[model samples]
Each structure stands twice: as C-alpha cells, then as structure tokens.
Target: MREFLIIGSKAKTDKFSLNDLPGAGRIDILCRCVSSAFFLSHDIRRDVNVYLLLLGPPDPPKVIKIVGREVKYMPPDERGIAGLIRKALEVKADESWKKSSPGIYVAKKGLEELLDETASDVYYLREDGEDVRDFETKDGLFVLGDHKGVPRELEEIILSKAKKIIGIPTKSLMAEHCITILHYELDRKQLNS
Candidate 1:
C-alpha cells in the first residue's frame, strides 16, 4: 500500500465553510492532496492511504487519516473533501484515533508520535533531495509539506528519521502534484516488474 503523510502547517482545525477553504488556513490544499492521493479517472485507489497533520490556530496539531480501502461517501472535488475534514474537526479527538467518518479518523498526535508508531519505511519529500527515479520501488510512508513548507525544526527531525530524502525530477512542485507523480512512478515500476 502507498501511504502518505501531508503536513498542513497552517490548516485550520475547526469546522470550516465550504466556500472558504482557502481562508481556513489553506485547507483547500490539503483537500486537493487527498483527491490526488487516491482518486483516479473513475475509481479510488484502494492501495493508498492519506494522513493530514493540521497545525493551525485554535488547534496546533490534529491528525486526519483517510484510508482509501475503506473510505465511503468521499467526493473527488476539493469542496467535498474539505467537507469531510470539517466534519472530522468538529468532533473531539485525543491521542487515540477516533472515527469521524467511514475510513476516516481524527487524532491529536504530533508528527513525532505518529512516526514512532508507523512501521513502514519513511521517505521525506523535498525539492533538493535525491531524485525518486533512482530510488528503489517499495511501499513507504511518504512525508510532504504543504505550500508553506516544512518548518526548520520539523525538517531536521524528519531528515533524521526518514529512510531517505527523495524528490521528483522537478523543483517546487505543489504537494498534490508531487503525490500524483509519486503514484505514477510507483505504478510504472509495478507494471514493469
């Protein structure tokens, strides 16, 4: 399975209106990342799982997990995806994950805590990192930061824990674009094998 952990450095942690995703600390970006991570031309990619770490005002850290294999009633558009996030934020969550919707869970864990619990190899995505094309094919927990980018302290921690720092052939790509390219590369490698 392909697992992704997208950090929303400024994404709001409270319920937000559908019309103001951008205003909600760019929750719109996270919504698009979710769409790119699992949705194809018609069907959802069941092999994929997405985690959103929201760190914004009123709430510093809230984790949202979307399991494609079990997710239901999720739409492909940003507004639809944001709706799910809004719902999740409305519920109370703690260190343990709480089911907010089908295949979607919310928790109050930071990046370090989540990484400590993850069993798979972790790949940190960065523009200046090693090219992903040269990396071996494997299922991994890929880490990405939203438009604001990973903070300096967090970057250091990720760099220390990640199995490898990898990137696509391009520079400064959007978080969603990076996810799409990663999936494409993985799909290509799987087909060739």
Candidate 2:
C-alpha cells in the first residue's frame, strides 16, 4: 500500500535503505555529527546524513533526511555536495544516540524526526537564477538542489535509491531494538544464505 504523510506520499519500495543501514551491515559503524562539508575544489562539500537523496529531470531538485531532521528540500549542484540551509521539521527530531558517521546518527527513536527537505535537486537547467545555479559537466549543465525547498516527487525517488544499497552502517548499529523494516529485510537475506 502507498503510505502518505501529511504533505507527502510514500510508494512502498520493494525495499528500503537496508543496504546502507545498520541491520544489513557486515558490522556496524555509527557516528554523531550534525552535518559537515569538506573543502572541495569549487563549492563546499556539505554531506547531510541523508537517508535518501534524489535528483530527477525536467526541473531538478533534491530530497534528503538528516540526523534529528525529517525529509526536506535543497538545491544541489551537478557535481557538488548537497546544499541544505534549514527546514521546517515535520516531526520531532531525535538527537540522542551513539556517534557514528557524518550526517548519519543513531537514535532510540526510529525515524522520529521528519524534516521537509531533500537532496534530489532538479531544475530546468536550461535556465539559471539568483542563488539557483548548476555545474556544467561533460554530461550537461545539470541542475542540483544547490539551495533549499526541494519538492516531494523527488524525495520519493531518493528514498527509492536508499532502498537499493545494502549493508550495515559502519557504527551505531542497533543490535537490540524493535525490528525496523530494514531489519526484516536483513533477516530475510540471512535466511536466504
């Protein structure tokens, strides 16, 4: 069934982020960092602990989920890191957890926070704007959510991407907790083995 949130809808993927989450990891690695950026050659390299990030066509935008935050939107460049300034959280965030990795965190509450953001940025790319820009690459002048306020259709796609990568998070893997949807998948994979 399709699960719809207050302002969004979730088309159940065949799977979710079990690949890049705790349940599926060979081992677990977790961390506690809000968000960070490395000095890349051009713009800043901001890495949001996003559960999902999607960039679609026509108009380009992004949807991302960060630690303690819910789904939110941002404008990213074609080849740069995510650009997320702030967001209006849809749910209460969970900041309490074991430190693990950048943007990735562990919390007692599973998906407790829901931000209105995303890492999937899409724009016309044919056009440009103030604060709205894209990077020209060999592929094309692809647009990104270089700013904030991404849309929902793109968010779903990112969530869909998270569905594919399979593995346990490096740190902060929850050995004892309510079995998340992710855990169920990991269990099945183990059983198949």
Worst ten-residue run, lDDT, model 1? 130-139
Which residue pairs collide in model 1, if any? Answer: none
lDDT of 2: 0.24
lDDT of 2 by residue, 1-193 (tens): 1011111112111122323322211111111111211222443234223332222221112223344222222223311121121121112224443333334322222121323222233212111222211122111111112223224564454344332222233333221121132223433554655
lDDT of each: 0.91, 0.24
lDDT of 2 at 123: 19
Score every model by TM-score: 0.97, 0.19
On TM-score, the leading prediction is 1
Q: How well does candidate 1 score on lDDT at residue 47?
A: 88
- CA deviation > 4 Å runs, candidate 2: 1-37, 40-99, 106-126, 131-152, 155-193
lDDT tens readout by residue for model 1, 14-86: 8777998999989999999999999989899998889999999787799999998899999999999999999
Quote the positional error of residue 164 for candidate 1 in Å.
0.4
- Show model 1 residue runs off by greater than 4 Å: none
Any idea how many clashes model 1 has?
0
Model 2, position 153, has a per-residue lDDT of 60
